[model samples]
Target: MTRRTFLRAACAAAVPASLGLPALAQPAAWPARPVRVIVPFGAGSGNDIVARLMGDHLGRALGQPIVVDNRVGANGSIGADAVARSAPDGYTLFVTTNTTQAANPALMKKLNYDPIKDFAPIGRIANTPAMLVVNPSLPVRNLQELITLAKSRPGKLTYASGSAGTLVPAAMLTHMAGIDMLHVPYKTIPPALNDVVAGQVDMMFTDMATGMPQVKGGKVRAIGVSSLQPVASLPDVPPIAATIKGFELLAWYAMYAPAGTPTPIIERLSRELQAAVNHPGLRERLASLGLQPVSSTPQELADFSRSELARWGQLIRSAGIEPE
Candidate 1:
């Protein structure tokens, strides 16, 4: 079957007739009150920024206030767990990234919620390539130079990681280059990027939205982008794949609700989300932050999540990162 046909069938099978609710309890007049969107990151992090932007448009479209709540920690697990346990009545939504739904399953030994089972897919929001940035004092001008310095110093160099998106790429660099660097973990990206700016840490792979400002301010220098090809936002920076063959990763955002949410509710939210991201003003705003705004159907998001789980799992294992 064609991919589109397959997705249609999968979505049909995945969504139940009543979504486990008594026919009378399906919230006939759905979204009767303000909806809360839980963001599993710190306030100034990329996920939080995107969540608020989308929330503003979505709230206006739905004629209800959209509340964005930042519940940070455990690589996004703390907030994810809250959403998982919330009422599946379409009131509590999750605006999160692959870190929580895909990489955490592979990186953590145990999780409170099932990435596939505990949440109903809403739709994808956007995608942004990460930038390999370092402190100005790191003495590396480009990817090749960083690789050389890393190899020479071995364990002396250190990289900071606040989430799986950053952590996975850092681990991939070590695995591909046969180099060793100390891994320093943080609760969120801003602080991790802060230390890199202060020269407490040597480098980090951060999303363009969070890292670009520091780069522009000269607090950090971007060596390469974490995509197979250079991104339009950073036209002059080369792709890290140019130095490390086949190295590519992109941080993405998506929305979800607790599992068993009514199919009608899920579909309506998905449509609104698609429209919100496609809004002309919102699109321009996202572009300014180096994010590519793209939306997907609920089924498409589900399929993508499954694929990412497997893809990131393999990469993590290859990097010799043990689950914790």
Candidate 2:
């Protein structure tokens, strides 16, 4: 090669280097437009609340507005599939709860997308425990009494569930405790909880956010929490594991982008999510909703996703829950 031509090529390469710009500095140019954060649930739901909370700060951090698109249906499958099919660009993100990612795989025979492979995990946001609640008017006061009564009546007692994930915990409890209870499914917990408060259903297992309100209002009686240990917010409430040893069921939220998103983008999202969860107001709001903020690295989230998928799959198979 001629020396002049070689020098020209060398200068071309050194231009960006001398300017202190990396080859991938274009990430700094990201968000030249607004980003969309899709939540696969309706408004007023726990997932929706968290998504908005994270989006608000994430928008400020990225210097762009983070729009929360709620496309609720098919137990969050529709919105989840949309995010899975979106471009792998960092602009489109999915803020999802366990219902779509973990429970739906076993509950549905054919999902539009594979939870683990279809998207890149950004980070885990929170884990919320479900409260085992019963109508205050019931003769049974505690979990043991309720189980004993259900055993005596077999399928006479009925329990309500808002979704497959919510039901699976109760189903697992019935199977493990050797009791049979009729299942009453609802579109969401608010309605199911309304029925429970009115004594239409004998019992139900709902998230602390929904159930605690009723329990405090004298609408329902909280028997136990579906956590290995009691939560700080409900210190008096016993852990279900205390009565049914090893009984534990909880739901978690995570963030993801379409598979093949750049690793730098994933890292950026994870950092922003960690920061959002660490914010004092967001942390307090999550705690008030009975959700404990938990931020995990991408690898850590991947491992958690795998473990949860396996655990819930095993429970579904053992309980003989057929896909719809």
Candidate 3:
């Protein structure tokens, strides 16, 4: 059978008719304790912030305390592994980004857990694009000029990455542009962006959450967007694909539970997540950070995860990056 057909059939089997209208258990006894939102990034990072926001809203909806657990290290593998190995109970949920679910699958040499097998996808939270910003000292006005300069300078130009995932798109751009550039890695994008704005680094692909504000404030010059289309937050910025065909890089956030969590619990969690993102306060906050809240059914999230895993794996291998 064709891949699409197989996928549809598989999803159908997983969600049989008997599972219709999600079984609602007694709400009073459901969340007897605090719900832990495990974030695989340092505090104040985009993922952590999103988790906290959602946690607060989810807490209100469930009438329980929602705590954020920041676990940072090894390009998010350390924290992701913690969630993967956690008990299948509904209390511990992972709020993560493309780094662990998509990029790390191929970027890491030995991932402690399989992203697909170790966690059950609850829902997709948001999709945010990154901005390609250059230091004022670069003298390049647009992506073409930057490429031309890189072609001329070769390995002299320097770029920075907050993490492997943050850098993967830049590395891919370098490979596609056929230009050699030095890569500088940082633990978070904020510091790296600071260096770019201060002219310490030549250029960097930065998170739209921080980069958009800086670009608007004239702190840094935004030359292009990583995605094919201009983002709503920055409509004037050109897409990289306008100069180089088929270029796209978008960071995303998702929710997941430890594998083997009961279907009823997963459904309940997905419902709560949908409600959380749909909340106006939470939606506005995410939008301010250049995050577009996206609600996805469990099957849709699973399909999206599968596709993202395949795409990022291709990019990471082509970039020749190794996990630490």
Could you give candidate 1's per-residue lDDT for residues 1-324 as a string of tens digits?
Answer: 999999999999777865755764744476788999999999889999899999988898898999999999998999999999999988999999999998998899999999999999999999988888999998889988898998899899999999999999999889998899999999999999999999999999888888878988899999998878777777888998999889888889999999999899999999999998888999988988888898999999999999988988888898888999
Candidate maximizing TM-score: 1
Show the colliding residue pairs in model 3.
none
- Quote the positional error of residue 3 for candidate 3 in Å: 76
For model 2, residues 20-126, the per-residue Cα lDDT tens digits are 85654654567689999988876666677778888988999989999999877777898889999999988899998888888898888789999999999999889
Q: Which residue pairs clash in candidate 2?
A: none
Q: Go through the candidates in order and give the C-alpha RMSD of each one to the true structure.
A: 12.2, 5.3, 13.1
Taken over the whole model, the C-alpha lDDT of each candidate is: 0.91, 0.86, 0.85
Candidate 1 TM-score versus the reference: 0.90
lDDT of 1 at 76: 96
Error of 1 at 46 (Å): 0.7
* TM-score against truth, every candidate: 0.90, 0.85, 0.85
